[model samples]
Each structure stands twice: as C-alpha cells, then as structure tokens.
Target chain A: MADASPIETHAHVLTLAEPLPLDSGRALAPVEIAYQTYGRLNAAKDNAIIVCHALTGDQHLASPHPKTGKPGWWSRVVGPNRPIDTNRFFVICSNVIGSCMGSSGPSSMADDGAPFAMRFPVITIRDMVRAQVALIDHLGIDRLHGIVGGSMGGMQALSWAANFPERCGAVLVLASAPRQSAQNIAFHEVGRQAIMADPEWKGGDYYTADLDDPRKVGPEAGLAVARMAAHITYLSEQGLTQKFGRRLQDRDAKTFGFDADFQVESYLRYQGLAFTDRFDANSYLYITRAMDYFDLAEEHGGRLANAFAGLKTRMCLVSFDTDWLYPTSESRAVAHAVNAAGAPVSFVELSAPFGHDSFLLDVPALDRVIEGFL
Target chain B: MADASPIETHAHVLTLAEPLPLDSGRALAPVEIAYQTYGRLNAAKDNAIIVCHALTGDQHLASPHPKTGKPGWWSRVVGPNRPIDTNRFFVICSNVIGSCMGSSGPSSMADDGAPFAMRFPVITIRDMVRAQVALIDHLGIDRLHGIVGGSMGGMQALSWAANFPERCGAVLVLASAPRQSAQNIAFHEVGRQAIMADPEWKGGDYYTADLDDPRKVGPEAGLAVARMAAHITYLSEQGLTQKFGRRLQDRDAKTFGFDADFQVESYLRYQGLAFTDRFDANSYLYITRAMDYFDLAEEHGGRLANAFAGLKTRMCLVSFDTDWLYPTSESRAVAHAVNAAGAPVSFVELSAPFGHDSFLLDVPALDRVIEGFL
Candidate 1:
C-alpha cells in the first residue's frame, strides 16, 4: 500500500475529448469524469468492476473523504476481503456527471472558462452512464466483470446493462427502484426549493469564494436545510427512534427555545452543516432533478422490460426490508422486468436496521448477497 | 342552523379573569380562549363535549375556514348526522393555546400590549389542557360527557383525563400517541431550524405587516418550507403514489430546470404557500416544542399506566393503520396501559389510505367507531 502512487488512492479524472449527448436535448463538451480505483485491473481487463454512487456520494469508495477527514462513505463494502473484495476485483467509483466531486458539473469550467452553474444542462442517468462509458473506453477496457450500485447508483448500473449489455457481464443493485416515486420527487422538490430560496444562492452564482461580500457567498444555510430534510428520508422512523429517542442533547430538561433540544435534531443539523463543506448546492439541484426525471419504463415507452430485451447480463436485485425510500416491492418490480426480458436475474429482500442506507452499512446479510452474486 | 346566533356559529373569546398556571412554571394573565359551540348544553351540563384541535387547527371544526373558505378540517366526522352528532351533544372546540387562531399565543398581545414573539413562555400539552379547563369553568360546566380529539387534539384529550379524571366521563383519542418519538421530534426540529435560519425570521420577531419593507416581515419562505416537510408525513406513500405518482404538473415534458415538474411537488408547494397565509411561524415553533415535550409516562413518574391510575373515565382509542406518524402500535400501548389501570377502554386499528390525517378525512369505519364509542 505504501508503494502505491498518491494518484492510486485519490481521484482519477478523465477529460472526455468528445462531446457527451444528454437526455435533455443538449450537448456537454470537454466533460470530465472523476473516478477512483482499488485493486489492479488484470491484463485482460475483464476483472474491472465499476461502482456507481448515490445522490451525494463521490469516488472515495475505500479511502478518506478529502475534505471532511472522515472515512470514505462506502469504506465498509469495498476494501480488502470486504463484500466487493478489492483483493479479487478492480473496483472503480466515479462521481456522477452532475456531482461536485472532481466531475464536470455545474461548478466546473464552461467553454468560456467560467463555472456553468445554473447554465449547465440538466443530466439524466443515461447521460451519466454515457460519460462513464467514455471513461471506460479511454482506459482501454473493452468490458467489465460487473457493475454495482445502490439507490441512484442502481439507476446507473441498470442503465449500463440496457445501453451497453456487453460492457458489464454482471449487475448487482441494492435498495433501488426502477424509477422515482411521486413522494421521491416531492421530497427532492423541497430540497431544491430550499436551495433556490436562499438569497446567498444568487441564482446559482454563489460558487465564488467571495469573502469580501457575504451575499455573494454560497447558499450554505439553504443547502443545509435541504440536506436535513433529505436526511430524514434516508433512515427509518424506528431507527431514528432507537438511536436518539427524544433524548435531550446535553440537558436533562428542555431548553424551551429554538435550539437543538433533541439529539436527533442535533444529528440532523450536523448532517446538514457538514454536507455544505463538501457539496455544491447547484449540483445538488441538478442531480436531484436528474433523479426525479428518471423512469426506465418511460424511456422505453412504458415498457421497463423492453429496456432489457433479451439481455444476456447476469443481474441480482437486492432490497432492504426497512428501506421505505425504495421498498422491497420496487426491487421486485425491477427483477420482474429484467426477468421478463429473459435476463438471468436473482432477487433478494434483505433485512436491515437502516433504511435506504442499509447498503452502505455493516449489513452482513447484504455482504453475503454481494459476495455470492459477484 | 340559520336561526342560531352569530356568537354560537362563530368563535367567542373568554378573557380569563383569573391567572392561568402553565406547565412551564409561568403564569399567564388575561388569558384568552377562543371557542365555538354547536347545539345547547343540557341542564345536567354532563352532555358538554370538549373537542380539542390539532396543531394548525382552530375552533372552526365543522365550519368553513375563515381564511381559505374551505370546509372545516374535521367536518366529515362532526355536524348533525355525523359521528359526534350535534343534535344531542353540546360540542365545544377551542383553539389551543400557543396556536395562532384567536387564542393567546406569540402573535397575541402580551401584558405590555406588544406581541410576545420569542419572548413567550414555552408551553406543554398540560398547559393547553389547563387553559381549556379555565374556558370550561367560565362556561359553568362541572363535568363533561366526553373529551374528543385527533393528533394533537388527542394529546389534549389524554391529558384531560390524566390531569382531571373526574371532569370527563369518556375520552376518545384518535391517531395519537402518549408521547413524541425521536423521529417526531426530529421532523419538528427541521421545521424550527428552517424558520430560524431565515434572516427574515429575525429571531421570531417578524410579526410586522409592513407594506413598505417586505423582507422585514414574517418568515413566509421558512414557514412554507416547514409546512412542505410536515405535509409529507401526513399522507401515506401508497396514497401519494395513487394521487400523484410520477404525474407531470401541467407540462408535456420535464422542464430540465428547478420547476414543479411533478404534480406531487406542485401539490406540496401549494400546501406550503397557502399555509403561510394563516399560520404564524412563532406559534409553529411553540406548539411543536410543546408536542415534543409530551410524554405521558415521563410526566407520570416513568409509567404510562400511572397516567390512567384507577381511572373511572371510559376511554376509546382508535388508530389509523397507515399512520406512520403515530402508528397503531402507539395506540395499542395506550390501550394496554389504560386497561391495566382498570379503566374500561376500547381499542381499534382501522385501515385508511390518508395516513395520520385519516381521522379528519371521510372514513366510514372511523365514523362508526366514534358514533358507537360516544
């Protein structure tokens, strides 16, 4: 590990020299995809595995978060002898097109060398997959052993088999649905409104680190509120109750004011605040919009099965029992669609205390499913 | 009826000549309780039924809302031929203290003739019940036939029996728990944070309706955001899906920007916007804090059964199966404790699509239960 290059543990950015076609009737040029790889790709390149990330995730799958100095968000599932087993597979996790990591997003430089910000075209899961395809091509990888993801990442993984069936031989999806529900869209909408309502956002022109003028700064408060709201959806009510349980924060009695009286409130506030340091608000807007627009069935004209028509890829769908975000029924729908398309698919509904976040947690059952499926 | 006096049809405010003691160890002088009554109280005065309203609800239980011109929030289960038939019962509903309706709240004039704003003392459910008791005393009622309510109203109903067991003969608590859970407190905290974070909130001092300076006024945006978040919890995922599942809002295609692309988003936005017209942000903060502090067991020396100790009040508890906010299990716990305390209590969990608000909606099963219970 010490002999490995600094680049090995950090992000690997691929500048797509070609224009990327988007689902929103627009073209994005000079695109960059930020990715990180663990374990070496075999000479045949057949051992290469790509990992798609969720809404606010980046490419630091098994390394430390560059900004927060915290462990990687998915460090539990993608290291040596772990579920994905970096020792046996070359795992790659890339920050999606509309994300803030090193990827080409709203915060990235435009053709005129200025941040695109709100001017950036809205992207879709398909568009995100296309960029990742270009990255794989640039790396001279003809095909990958597998593609894995949970939540929004599952959308990308599913899209990969539809668009590039031969690129990835296997697909493993966790805690995902075929598309976003009305409740899903509604929650995301609240987050977007929260960001847009902030005066500091300045019509998404708050990317500049303007210390001179506070109004020109980024929409931290709005972004934090957005995160706080979304954070509530990621966990189960039972989990939150078990963890915090109306317990006061460092007090035996209530403060009777607008303070974080409960521990859960303090936890959510901290989640919102810490998120502002590492993510861009505009990017949050764009990526969530992309997710809201995601409907595999609609893309194939109300036929989700048509997306995987006669697919040869081996796929496994996994859902968490506690994941209200994308309940087991959602995964079952995906499995039915893929199975109807004549693809080899296996489905499992695992039990976990965490909700949508079970895929990233220490769920031994999920680890076994992934290990077996891979 | 058309022959009824305007005072009977509308709200009547009673300025308490005596100081009202609160659970927060503070006394409120010149306390006002705005109440509405339907039908006449019998000579025995035992037929007087006190109906408690939830947070954001007022005394207009079966009448049209003053601002929205919409039917009363719980009109489906009230009125002449309804569950709690007005032909027999002298139904009375008072706007809870710490609420913005005609009651004495943060928006109401303090002793100094200025709004209390954030200076208002923190209130609890017991505090609300105490105010109601004073109102009942003013009306010359000794004993009530029943105390009925849903959600926060249910909290008040339960508190009435616990605090003044001999004052009421029967208690009907619908879709409510004896206390707030961590998830409940967490959701509330998000709303409070949203309101406080808005610079326009000005530490809850944004009560001025200044036409010259709009920004110096109330925290509309923050309050709207709070409502949007809270509104989601009021409906079930299945219901939201059935009502507005992936349906676009007056558009042929996605706008590719931050707009209400989905009907659910539009619906939520409308709910948030319309809520700002009638609700005060400071009252929302105070009431939510009171709700969070509600723990019957904690107040009864860490045993819920103690709240109903040797209770003579016949109680009926009903829960909506779809209500994740206050699930059926919560009601079951209450029933168990009351039964253990030798109180004649009936418990039923009814199926409803609307989640926590099912008690307010047109559910025939609930109507029957209410009718039979009373």
Candidate 2:
C-alpha cells in the first residue's frame, strides 16, 4: 500500500503586488503564495481540508522532501487510512509567506531583482492565514471541510477559524496557543541572536555576497546555536533524560578536555548542522517574528472570545501534558474562548513525554484523537 | 544585625601527593583543596557546618569575593539570623578540586610549572568530598553539625552523607541530585566541545602562548553556547515565557535580517557573556566531568541506601516544582534512600517558578523551611 501511494504532490504558486492591510495598520504588498495539493477536488470542492505547517515547516505536507530525502513532516497523521485521510478528503498545504520554500520570503527577489533579506516586512500569524485565504480563493474553494495543524500550524488553524469562521467546517489545533508567551518568545529571540552574532551571516545578503560572510547570512555557528535551542523545546526533559542521560559519547573517562563527551552533545550538533541544510536563516528570523506577533485577543480588543466571536467551526484542540512550550493551560484558554464564542469545541490533554512534538511522533493516543476527530 | 555579626573567614589550601584509594579502583593524588571558614568552633567542634557551592561557585560562601565585588552566593541563607545562621554554627565552603577558584584545577600549576589545563586528573564528586574530609582533619573537626548545599553543592552534601556518614550531624540538600542525568551531562559535553572547537583555545595552552590560538583556552563562542544551553536547563518553560515571551528586542517587526531582534536574544547574549567573565572555560570542562562521574549509589553496589548506610545525620532535601534540572523525583529518590538507611529525613517540593535556581532566590517558604530545620 505504501508503494502504491506516490510521495510527490503537485504544487502551484500565485503572486500579488497589491498592499495587504495588516492588524497593526501596516500594509504588505507584492506577496507570493506557494502551495501544494493532494488528491483531486470534487465538483463541489466540499471534500477540501487545509493543513498548516508549524514554524520551520513548509508545504509538501504529504510528499518526500526533494533535498532532505525525508518524508513530509505530517505524513504519519495525513496519509491513507491515517487521520486526515487523503482517501476521503482533498488536502492543501501552503508555504507560508515568510518561508524560503518557493514562498515570498527573505530569499525571494524584489522588484530590483535582489533578495529581500532584511527588507522583508515582519508578518504576523493573522497575515499568514490571510495569505492562505487568498490561496483558497485562488483555488476557487469557498469552504474547507477542516483546517488542521500543530504548534505554529495550530496557530494558523485557530486563526482561520477565528478570522473566517464560516469558511472552515472543522478545526484541529494541536499543541498551540492564542498568543506567543514571554518565555516562548524569549527562546526564539535567543535563536535569532545566535544566528546574527555569527560573523559569517553578513547581514542577510549572503546569497549575493561571497557566501563565506558570517555577519550577514552564512553564520553557520549562529544557526547551529539557534537550532540547538529550538531542539530542546521539542522534547520533554524526561524524554531527553531517558534518551541521552549523562552517557558519554566516545570516551569512557572525560579527557578533562573540551570534546563531545556525551551523546546529547553529539545529538544537538547533528540537529544543528542538519537543520542548516534544509532551512534558510532569514526565513527563520521572519517566521519566528510572525509567531511572536501572534496575539488573537490583542487583535480583537483584549478578549480572546471576541476574536472567535461568531465562529461556526467544529474545533478539536489537543494538548500534550509534557509540552512546556504550549502547556495545557494555553489549550484550555482556547477551549474556553471557543466555548464563550458559542462554537462547537472539544479539548483533550494527552499524556505524552515527547513535549510539543508529540503530535508528529508515534503517539497512538494522539493518532486515536486525530482519527476520532477527523 | 547583618554587619555586627561578621564572621572571620580564612582561605587555606591542603595538598596530598600520595595516591588516594577510590571506589573505582583508581588512586589520585597531589590533590589540593582551597577552602574558607566562617564563625568559631564550639568546645567540641561539633558546630561545624560545611556549605558546598554549586557548579562555578567557590569557597567565598559568606565573605566578599576578592576578584568580583559580589558577595558569596549563599549569603542570604548563611549569614547571621539566616537559616543556617553563621553566628551559631561554624560554616565552611570549599572550592572543589576540579574548579578554578583557587583550587587545584586545570588552571593550577602542575609539577612542571605550567597550567595543568587538560592534564588535570579526571576528578569525581566523591574525590571532591574526600579532599574536604582532609580539610576537616586538618581543622581537627571530628564531627560537623551539618552539611548544606544546593545544585552541585547538594551533590557534595549527599556525598558527605554517603562517604562519611558519621561526620555530619545534619545534611540539607537543595536543588540537587545523587547523580547527573544523561541529559544534564549532554549539555556539559556540548559546552566542552564548543570550547575545544574554538580556534583560539590552542589545545588548552592558550595561557602560555603569545599568538591568538583558539585551541589554547579562549573558546568564548563555544563557552557562550554552552552557557546558553545550561541556562535553559536552569529555567522552567513558564519562567522563560513569563520573562521574555514574544517581545522583540528594539523593533516592532522582524528584521528579516540576522540580528538580535528579539528580547530573548539579548537576554541569552547577556547570560552567555556574563558567565565567561566569572568562569574559566577549562574549569567548566573539568567540573562538568566531576558531576557526570558522580554516582553515590554505584559506589555502594547499586544500592543508594547502602551509600548512606548507618548515617546518623538529620537530612532535609528541598526541591522546586519547576526545576527540571534536579526535579522532585530526584529529591524523592534521595529521601527514600536516606529513609531506607534509617536516617531522619525531611523532603519538600516547594512551589516556585524559578526552576533550579529557586534555592538561591528569596523564596520565603524556603527560608522558613530552612530556618525551622536549622
């Protein structure tokens, strides 16, 4: 069955130069939408579901990545017979505006034929959802049977339900929040600084420069630091302890010298180095900003419920107990807001030691939740 | 009242050149100890309470540091009218053998008159405590009223109870564990590797070299990464969220450039740079190894209880709810071990948002607990 199912899906893009009105009264223009679709849309297009990827994630939700040879991040939960089954529903995933995966991001060429780099406008979670909405309109789909995501994806899903309630039939939000908390924002900031501090970064225009410039774009050291920081948030402390507890890497006794002496150290290095290959540093900076700017309530006059005022989607929110990133309280807050908005909502906190990334891992209970919800 | 009851503290050193038998069947010697004492010894010298400092801390427990203007780390809990009142009990804090603060560490001169650096013997927590025992012998203190410490300090306190149960009348451990978990060790390894990877380090001999050799010692970048990694472990996700959230550093939008745009970025930079000023990169390498080698139970045939067999010390173990570093489970394990050994033990998991550093902060409840116990 796996062999029968092709891993590559067709993708398309649309560009616009008109200014987009932002929540902060700023306008974004000349935007480009990069997206992919799986399965065929029926005549009514009622079987359509939109999947939003998290921070650092791109489109290609059900396909093998061209550069990394890894399967699409959500393949486990979005394939045939899995939750959000493609057999019954047509799925659409889009490369967010600030992303580098063929999307209009820092690497995209400006009117002057130069990479946007530091010139790209800061985007918000709502802005990302707006771009998705434009793509749906371009695809001629008036309504989605469901909108699903986790972490940053979860943020987009909630944004769709709250921003265009009538357009979404159901929303599945896993391990997300209504706004970026102070600590969450702090961690992302640390990553950004780490990348910027690298002398090779060269501002953000390493693409046009000698590529070896560390201060602008090619700051591999800083990027590695950022990746290491983010990787820690993806796993629970218990998970980390269980997987790599004080185990030395190559030597029995510490050489009393600076070396990779523990398994966790090696793992973090791999994570950092591997991440740089697939991700663009500038995109990291922009996407993290979008996440940091996300505040559903703040956009709707300080009442989260007001943001979802008149939403008509069936919402299922899932949280992982060990996910310190967007803990159970954040999920509960969303559930409360949805309930207060008089929308249909279901919320559950699952026991998973994988932290915020449990949704992407092999958690049978999470699978069950997604299966039942879908 | 704080100034009037000033204690006379003196810094002294003890060196042993002969081989000292270890549980691991190894003998290490020419070991040196740097320590300080506060207050006066009672008629029987039973009022001596050894205060062990955490990683990067030194012998200046209650007195002012000569190098840095900062007072001793545990001054709040160890001064007059404090929980472990210096007026009533003689307090002694020692710079662990593997550390840099005037102890026999990697930076100390060897027989060849050069900084030991990587040549320093791989030391363990037990070895550190053993050196303390020699110091006690030198001071003619047959028994101590208590042994107090937090984090790594707590490790030494636990070691005291395990290796010389008859020497301590009471033992108070704060924010510590019996052994380093794999995850904890992994962080230290990363730091070590970072230092080693630096071009300026000059293979631990940077101190003697006139040229800018990255390998000799000044792996500032790597050390910074290590500090950043360790700093995260010292904090709870909630604390991070509360402290920095998604706030941008100096702008309202993502720079799309490689810069410290987020407040968290600036915070981490401050944390990393500040750490290097007060710490030695080489000492970080050795001390972390000592922590990783610490296994109280393994020293007693895999039975943690046996490590503290026949102990007469009154034990108090304090844990913070948000501390993933040495979580409550670790403290509970120690309490269970002490209980099995028939020692009088008190265990409490205090509610605090500061994570592992809660013990150092002004948690009134913690003060009350210590005050009541002492």
List DockQ for all candidates.
Answer: 0.80, 0.39
Best by TM-score: 1
**What would the TM-score be for candidate 1 when compared with the true structure?**
0.96
DockQ score for model 1, please?
0.80
Among residues 3 or more apart in sequence or in different chains, the pairs in candidate 1 whose N, CA or C atoms overlap within 3 Å are: none
Estimate, for each residue in B1-374, the C-alpha lDDT of model 1 and write its tens digit.
Answer: 21222223556898988878877778877688888888788888878888999988999987888878987776766777667777788889999888888889998888887788888888999999999888888889998998999999999999998989978878999999999998888888888888887888888787765423544258888889999999998999989999999998999988887778789999999999999988889999999999999999999999999999957979999999889999999999999999999999999999989999898887888889888989
lDDT tens per residue, model 2, A1-374: 22346543688888865766666466666788888888778899899989999998888788888769898887877766667777778889999988988878888877787777878777788888888888888778999988999999999998898788888878999999999886676667657766665556678776854433544336666777788778877888889877887677887755543456667877988998898887888888889888877888977898999988868768999999999889999999999999998988999999988888898898888888877887
lDDT of each: 0.87, 0.80
* C-alpha root-mean-square deviation, candidate 1: 2.8
Interface RMSD of each: 1.0, 3.8
lDDT of 1 at A285: 96
